[model samples]
Structures are given as structure tokens and as C-alpha cells.
Target: MARHVARPDPRAHWVLLLLGLVTLLAALSFHGLVSAVGGGSGPDQAPASPAPRAVTTGGPVLRLDGPTPVSRRLPARTLALTFDDGPDPRWTPQILDVLRRHHAHATFFVVGSRVDEHPELVRRILAEGHEIGSHTFTHVDLTAAPGWRAGAELSWTRNAIAGVTGREVTLFRPPFSSTTAAMTEAQYEALRNAAGSGHVAVLADRDAKDWQRPGVPAIVKAATPQGGAGAVVLMHDGGGDRGQTVAALDQLLTRLGTQGYTFTTVSAGIGAPDSMVTATTGARLSGTALRWAQTGADWLTSAMNLLLGVALVLGVVRLAVQVACAQRHVRRVRRPRRRLPEVVAPVSVIVPAYNEAANIAATVRSLVASAYPALEVIVVDDGSSDGTADIVERMRLRGVRVIRQANAGKPAALNTGIRAARADLLVLVDGDTVFQPDTVYRLVQGFADPTVGAISGNTKVANRRRLLGRWQHLEYVIGFNLDRRMYDVLECMPTIPGAIGAFRREVLFAVGGVPADTLAEDTDLTMKVLRAGWRVVYEEGAIAWTEAPSSLRQLWRQRYRWCYGTMQAMWKHRHALREPGAGGKLGRRGLPYLAVFQIVLPLAAPAVDVFALYGLLFLPWSQLALAWLGLLLLQAGTAAYALRLDRERFGPLWTLPLQQLVYRQVMYLVVVQSVVTAVVGNRLRWQRMVRTGEAAALVGGAPAR
Candidate 1:
């Protein structure tokens, strides 16, 4: 089981959140109008009630055409509390107790599936005089493909709930709160047409992001509203975990009760009446509209829930991996080497060159000057049309060999060099990368330990004068280094830096050389080595420096490929994830951890995206303002800590927010794309980022003075 960490709410700008109610109302009103006018059946004809209008005081007024809600005038204090998306056995009862204590009536949009398992809860909800609303069968987000499945979902839940309550349910809340103009129109028409005797649709005015697992404070903050306005605060009684939600409601309701607030049922507040009408006809109609509405509503609901399930699974998977791997530690056994070994085995340093014309010479020079005993620098030029390889050839360095090849990509080039290597060990470096004089010595020394099959070097951005470069520097220090340490602890280092990584020649051969099919050869090789029972070690002292992408666009592309490649590698080794380690119980716990923490997390991130936007658009101003302050402080802390780690970089600390604004979403997008690709079985080929000549052109302001 993965450790659960509550994600901070995204409504970071609490002070600026005052307009949420107004925005939500406006959106609701706009949607209502668009649906009603655009081919809607008749004005809501259900038991007498006023026309649906988005209002601050009241929740969504359902305007039905046939057997639809009859729009009638009502007082501002006439607010109906509507909860959607649950029948959570864990939390729904707590919400019920509070409502019963307050003698307040509300509506619960129960999921169909939940009602089937816990029939008593649905019966109790209905028996207690709280109106019941359909939130689809599975609580699926209706926005996904195969939108028609919602009909079955709705019918299933409705029948289950009715079986227990022996009462008909009329209201419907689309899963994910998503309703298209077409779907809404169809749902309204279908509901009224299907209305039997007396059933009405329930809509909400206010929404609390209880589904997101916000803490009790944040939940209360969102649920409480501005207090002055008579409002229907939306809460969930079901779907996933709602423990915090149930607990928060008790506090919110009690506090509000002290302030003399009250709640009412939709039927009672709107004034019960006989028979609903088709909104279009404003006259009694057949049950056809009601059935159509039910069908459409169900399909829509199923689509939404399906999407939500996929998202949830992704998050849970990542969480599982992170938790499982967090405890295991990989022992780092560094061999002591005071001097170079005698008869110095010839070393082949393979540099996979792309368009590195500017830095190729310098990179080659660094390799030539390495203080190793015997070394052979093989620069496999991966079809760089630029003068990169030419410059290396012109240098005529004694031990350096420039091998020109067609543009077969990085993995292929590395494979070529490995096949040709005559040395005992092979060092792979990117063409644009430059290594320190002592890097080879430090890297080779680790091989003295027979278990250390391959070794990774620390990567630092060579140029950090620019803000982007500086931020990248901090990222390497805080993000990469921390990750490396964590992976070292787990004994499953999943990726070796492509800039400079050394491997035993035999180990490379055993893994069938570098996998040519994957975009991330280094990551693929790392997993393969671990799977084959070879241990990977990290050389903290064997540092290599290379240029970092200078702009957000460049960084996005680079990181995007990395993420996509990671997913590909994860897919390749998924079987190993379930394999037991030395014990018969579990083969490799580390693989599972990597899958959950690194591969599965990107999909879960979308919840934060939705929370951020919704909070800005719907949350109360004060709470929104407070949330923003909290977010800012968190960002500030992250920046300060990151900067402290890489104080040598100028703007790394100051650029944290900017990085979140420009870069974070890109990362999220890449993660999302990776998930999509994995599901669709799309193959990712290696695509190198174009190197800017600036890093090489940069003259020393002061080199490690």
C-alpha cells in the first residue's frame, strides 16, 4: 500500500477568490440558457417550482420541459443542500447525522454502484426525508470516450436505490460536474418525459472540492461560503475516500448553526405541486422525455466516471511505487584507488555526437586530457551535418577516433561504438558533454568492485549565468541528486546520466547492448542491468557538465522526451515489477516502487490542475486568498531550499514561481502524453534536443575561481 499524502489545495489566491460564487452562477446560468433554448423539450413541467436560474443564494434550479421542474418564485433563504458523487459508507452517515441533528433536509447524488452494495444507506438517505439524486452508476467522469455507457450506469444505480427506498428518484447530477450543451438538453428533456407521478432534478449553487481530499480546514473553508448569502453548499457523501469530507461537514454545520443558518429540502423549499410539464410545451407530456433524459444522463455519467477511474488508478499506482521503494536501500561500495592500475586496460570513451559542432572539440579535448592509464576516445558522429566531427578529426588527438555514421539516433550509435570497443570497460558520453580530467579515473575505480556492473556520474549544467541555466543547475542539485541518493538507497538506480556513464564491457553485451527501440537508452539499460542481476553504482565524484536548455520551450521538449522514454522503459520492464526478489514472496520491490512513484504520478497531477482552476473560479474570496498565501509560502520554501543547495547559481531561487508557471504545466502535459502513449501502445524513438551554440561560445567570467 502506498503512503497517502494529502495534496495541498490549489486555491492559493484566497484573497482574490471572492468572485467564485458569481462566476459559478454566471457559468450555470449560461449553461442553463444554452440548453433550454437550444432544442430543449418544454419549460420544466414537474411539481410546481420556479424556473432554473443561476443564483448566489440558491442552487441550480432544474428547468424541465415535460415532467420538468415548474419555475416559480421563491424567497432568497430557500436554499436546498445537494451532495453529489457518493454513498460513501465511511463518511455519508456522519453527514446524515449532522443533517438529522439540524432538522435540515438536503439531496444526495448517489452513485448507482454504491447504492447496490450499501442498500441501507440509500434507504436511510431517502427515509430521512433527504431527496435522492442520481450521480450515475459508477461515478465515472462523463467526459471520456464511449459516452453512451452512462445510460446503463444511471439505470443500474436508480433501480438499486429505488429497490432499497421503494421511492422514485428524479434528480440527476452529471459525474465530474461535466455537462455538454447537447447532453444537458437531452438530459432535461429525458428526465421530465420520464417523470413518474413526482420526481424533480436537483442542481447545486456551491461546490466544495471535498473529492480532492482537502484537509478538514480547507474543506470547511470551501464549504462554509461567505455566510451572508443563503447558499446550498455542495458536498459529496460518496466516491472513493470521504473521511475528511464527513468530518469537515460536522464542523462546518455546527459552526454555521451557531451563526443561525438553516437548510431545507428542494421539494419543501420550492413548494410541492402536482405534475411536471415539458419545458418546451409547458404542458403535460408522455414519459418518453423522462426515459430519454435518463438514458442520456447515464451515458454521460459513465463516460465521466471511466475517465476518473483511469486518473485515480494512475495516482494510486505512483503512490504505491513511491511507498514500496522508499524503505529499501542500495549499498554504495566505493573502491579506494590511490593510483592508476598497472598495464592499464585500454578504455573506449564513446561520444554519441549530434549537432555539437561548437562543443565537440572541447569535449574531445577533455577526453584526450583524461588522466587514465590507457584510453581510446571513439566519437561516434550520429550524422551531424555540422562541422562537429570535422573539428574533432582536425585536432588529430593521438588516442581519439572519430567514427562517422548515418543518423541512426543515439541508441544505435552507442550500440555501434560498444560493438567496436576492444577495451575492458566502456564510457558513454554525449557529444556536447565535457568531462573533468579526473572523471575517468573516478568512474573506473568503482569497477574494482565486481558487483558494480555500471556506474553513473553526476551531471551539472556547465553554464549557469542565465536564469534558466541557473534554475536547471538547482534542479540538478536538488531534484536529480536527491533522486540519485534515494535510488542508491533502494539499490535500483533506474537511469544513468547520458552525459557520462561507465559500464563493464561484458555487462553492456549481456543486456544485448543498448536497446535501440526506446528513446531513453540510458534508462532502458539501467533497468535491464538490474533485471539481469547486475548492480548499478553512482560515482558522485565523477562529475560531468553539459549545457542545459536555456528556454522553457527547449526545456519542455527535452523533459517531454525524458518522461515519454521513462514510460516506455517502465512498460518494457513491467513484468519485473511484480517479480519477487531474493525471497519467494516478492522478486523485486524496487521495480514496483519505480512504476508507482515515477511512471504513474503524471496522470494523478490533473486533479491539481482541476482544483487550481476550480478554486480560482468558485471558492470563496477569503478562503481563496488564504489558499493562495499558503501556496506562495510553499513555493517560497521550495525556492529557498533549492537555492541554498545551488547558491552559486544566480536566479534559481527567484525563478521558482516562473518555473512553476511555465515549466511545471509542460511537465504535466508530458506526463499526460506519456500515459496516453502507454495506453495506446505507441513506440517512442530517440529524439535529441538541438544544441544551442551559446554554451560553448560563453567565455569564462571566472571558472571555479
Candidate 2:
């Protein structure tokens, strides 16, 4: 009894995958790993506005919320050292070492995202008797950002700090801020909002400009205060190479200490209380979650990038191997050599039909018109409801016979046809395929060498008037035929396509007459013949035209069956890897090639598109476009060469790019579904395509009366 096969809908799995991808991209944007939508910049480059003289000249710390806005200057002979855009793993530690050696205390205004990345550094700053302040998350300019963004930035930084050290900070420094005298109105207004939230805005009075990486002397000169007046010096520990900042800080600290200058935290310099406070439990929990979430997103993005790179290398390597091997095969075929004896042996052609009434008459007539001297045609109708056998019988073509059987499937029908055949050599043809007059003659010529067990003929897509048809035509020439040449050269040809293939009658019986265990009977039988130690070769001169699916749904079904069946066949012949002789060659070479290029590469192919979308969103478009174009051109060159080898027209090459966008994706999805179905141990039924008589129309073959 046949086991019942269940078709499972995989829509839910795909939906979940899409949602997860979207969530990851959103996380990356939020963490500033990718460019955020509408993200604003700092106020450093903005035009200056009128400023309050007292706040500008008096102090670096200000309180703007009280009825009387006030500013207090640092004590005489004292300096408050502040670093922005940290805590970087590199440079920050070096600067801290210098401060530790000098016994100087300073403040670090940390970006929230970086705080999450290096929480231990934040904790160390607080432990070493230094202060921690908010530089706003992602270092966005509070003055230029939307009102809500300013608040969120400050809040997120506070939460990140609280999560790391169990404390909250009230000291805040807006990114790109400088001396109060240079403040724009937008900067002042942003400060007022911070004051409303109980934040002490800390602006620098002396800009060290070490971020420019100027000489250490320049940074020292800029940071020093004239005479004994106290000042707040600004520098950076992150955002780029900060070698100069670290060196300048060490020298500046020594010079100031010798001048009887005292170093203090930002709050203490102005005689204010400590800005750090214990964080709420809720804040700590929320911030920890946010930190881990960002870390996971970072790891995932790294992994995806690595996989994309590996897939690219594999794809390129496969293309190079195919082209090189194909060229070698072409050279060998074109070289002058002694010709083999002409094969005049009688041949039997087997046509397996199931609901193929639309094309059976034309199929039989084409076979009857073969140029071979002695030929017999057999049509096996496997319980076709459309009277396929009756149509063939009415043709009354000479030496053609029709046999009826219960619908036992294609493999069984082919076996029945093999049992009825009388000739020593046999050719298998699909019911919807139309053969050229010399196809049989050329296909049988391979049998002149008794070592040849089977010969695979070139199969072309006949219905090439439509875009879908043209795409398949290109695939046949470029993907299938080119690969066959390479396989033939390697002496491990895998599949003799059902559209047109010839086999010795004894070789068929020796391989157990078309194994019915797998959906891909052709591939299964071919592998069996190879494992039996008989050589299989490809005859490029024999051409058979067959109809390709015209609609997307039909194409999907047909390809899904093909992919799933091929996998099943591969699994069945897996032992060939360890076996000696020709089977081992198929296992070691042909199977691995199929597994990598056909299965694994297609599985990873979607990553290319995903990264392309990522590049469009966050990377330079010009670079991405050039890279994509280079790959497309490489593929086009390969396709052109394959078409030239097959003697095909270049007209279908125009659809190559569109095929990558649409048809290629469909084929990838088919492989994905087939893999998923196989993993779940689901048996797939044989899927038959609707006959359209397109093959007969293309070959100009008239139906038999």
C-alpha cells in the first residue's frame, strides 16, 4: 500500500522568520549600528547666537531652572577634566592609567550604547573615585534632535549607567557642545530642558582639541588656563584614534600639578554636591534587558555578514570551476581524433504518458519520423483519464504500439515499457517531448563504445515565446547543459534527463529497471547505472525540445518535486561515497558538487539579497551598485558562453537580470521548501505538468491522423 503523503503549509514559519528579521534590523538601527531614520546631528557646525555674558565668561556649570538662573566658576588654581564619547575599550584605559598615575580625578560622559558594550569600564570609573555623566545615547546632538529624542537620549544614558553601576547620574553633556559663548539658541533651550529634569549641564570652558590629533603641545596649550583662573577642559576618549589625547592628558596633568593646580570632578570644581544617585530597581532591570538585546543584535549581524561572505566565495568558486571544466570539455571535443564506427543497431523508444492526450499523437508521430534505420516506439499509458492510450492507438503509426496499465506512477510505467521493448538499445522520452529527426541516431552513437551504459541528450525549452519560457531556456543552456559538460569531463555525469536519454537494455535490467523509491526516477536510475560500474556520457548533438511550465504556480510545483526527488535520490546513493570504482567518483565529486552549488548555495543565496537591502539602507549606494553590477556581468558572461556552446540564440539573454529578480527567487524558494519537507520526513507525490502541445508546435511536427 502507498503511504499517504501530507502537504504542509509553511506560511507560518516564513512569517515568523520575516518578523524576526525586521526586529533585528530595528534593534541595529536603535543601537546606531546602522543609520537611523531622521537621526539628527550636533550643533558644533551651526551658526552661533547671542549668549548670556555671565554664563559664557563665568563658569562651565549652570542652573537654568530656578527663578534666578545662576552659574558658578571653578575655584581658583583648579581644573575639572571631562572626556566625551567613551567608554571605548581602547584609549580609554590608557587615559585612565595616566590619570591614575597622576592621582587626578575626572569625569567620563559616556554614550549609552558604548556603556552597554563595556559595562566594566563604566564600573571602574566610578570605583576609581571618578564621576560618570551622560553624553546622551548614540552621541546625538540634543539641541538638533526632536524634543522627545533629547529626553529619550538622556533617559537611556542614565538607565545604562544605572544598570552598570547601580547608580544614576544627573550630570549631562550634549554632544558637540563647547564654551557657553558659542552656544546657539537651540543649545540654550536644550540646556533648559535638561535643567527641568534636574540635570546639571556641564559645558567646557577650554577646548583641548585633541580630537583633531594635533601635536601634544597644541592640545596642552589649548587646555591650560591663563594665570591661575580655573577651567573645565574638554577632550575625547572615543570616536576615533585618540593617541594624542592620551599623551596630551598625561603632560597637561603633570604641568598643572606642578603649578599648584588641583584637579576635581565637574560637580566638585563648582562646589556642587555629587551628581551620582542610587538607581531604582525598575530602571536597572529595564536597562539590563536593553543592553543584552543590543549585544544579541550585534552578534547576529556579525554572523550574517560572515555567512554572506562564505556564500559569495562558494558561488564564485563554483562558477570558475564550471567555466574551466566546460572549456576543457569543449577543447577535447573539438580536437582532431579518429572517429568511432557508425552505430546502426536497432533502438526502442519508450514514451511514458499520464493524462498526456494533448501531445501523445504528436509525440508518436515525431518518434515514427526518426531518421534511424530500425526503430520501435512504445507508449505506456498509466491510467490516464483523458484517453491518452486511445489517442496513440488511433494514430496507427507503423512500428508504434500502445500499452495500458493502472496508474502505478511514472517509474512503473517506464518499467512496463522496458519489459515490452524488443531492441537491445532503448531511448526514454517524455510524452510532451518532440525529437529532432536525427536525435535518435546521434543518441545511439555513444553505444559504439561498449563501456558506455547511458547517454544523456540535451533538452531545450520549446515554449520560449513568453518571458517565463525564455528564463527556463536560459537555465537549460547555462545552468543545466553547461553543468553537464563539466560533469562529463569529470566522468561523473549524475542525471540523464527524462526528456531524452538512451540506455543499453542490459544496463536497464542490471540497475533493476528504474527504481520507484524516489520521485526523480531519471536521476535515481542514472546513479544506479554509475554505481554498477558503467560509464554514463552526455551527447550534446542529440536535441529534444520539451514544454516548460508557463505559470509561476505550475513552475513552483514542478521544481519542488524535482528538488525534493533529487535530494531523496542523493540520500539513497550516499553509500557510493565509500564504495570503490565509478560509484565512489559520483559520491566524492558529483554528489558534493550538487550538495554545495545546488543545495547549500541556493539556501544561502537569499543572504545576498538581504545584505543588498541592508547596504541600500545603511551603506554607500554607489559601492553597493558597482559590486552588484560586477556580479551580474560575470553571470551574463557565463550565460553567453553557455549559449554559444549550445548553438542557441542570444535573444533570451535580455531576461537574465529579470530572471534573477523573480524566477531565481522562485527556484530558491522551491529548494528551501523541499529541504524543509525532507527534514520533516514528508513523502511528496509525483507532480505532473499540464500538457500544452508547445513542444510539437516548436518542432513543426504535425499530429498523426
Estimate, for each residue in 530-588, the C-alpha lDDT of model 1 and write its tens digit: 87777787766787878788777778778868888876787777777565541111126
- Report the CA-based lDDT of candidate 1 relative to the real structure: 0.64
Off by over 4 Å in 1: 1-345, 578-590, 620-651, 681-685, 697-705
TM-score of each: 0.56, 0.93
Best TM-score goes to which candidate?
A: 2
Question: Which segments of model 2 are wrong by more than 4 Å?
Answer: 1-10, 27-58, 63-70, 147-152, 192-198, 337-339, 701-705
The lDDT values for all models are 0.64, 0.85
Candidate 1 contains a number of clashing pairs equal to 74
lDDT of 2 by residue, 1-705 (tens): 999887557686577656755775665455444123121123346445746566666577888888655877788899999999888899789989999999999999888888998999998898899999988878776767898888888888888888889899998888888887677677878988998888988888888877777799999999999988899888888888889889899899899999999998988887778889999998898789878887887776677778878877887887888999888988887786457888988999999999998778877888888899999999999999999999888877899999999999999999999999999999999999988899999999889888999999999888888889889989999899999998898889989999999999999999899999999999999999999999999889899988889899899999999999999999999999998888999999999998987798787666556656666777788998898799889889999999999887777888988998999888987888899889878788888898777776755642221
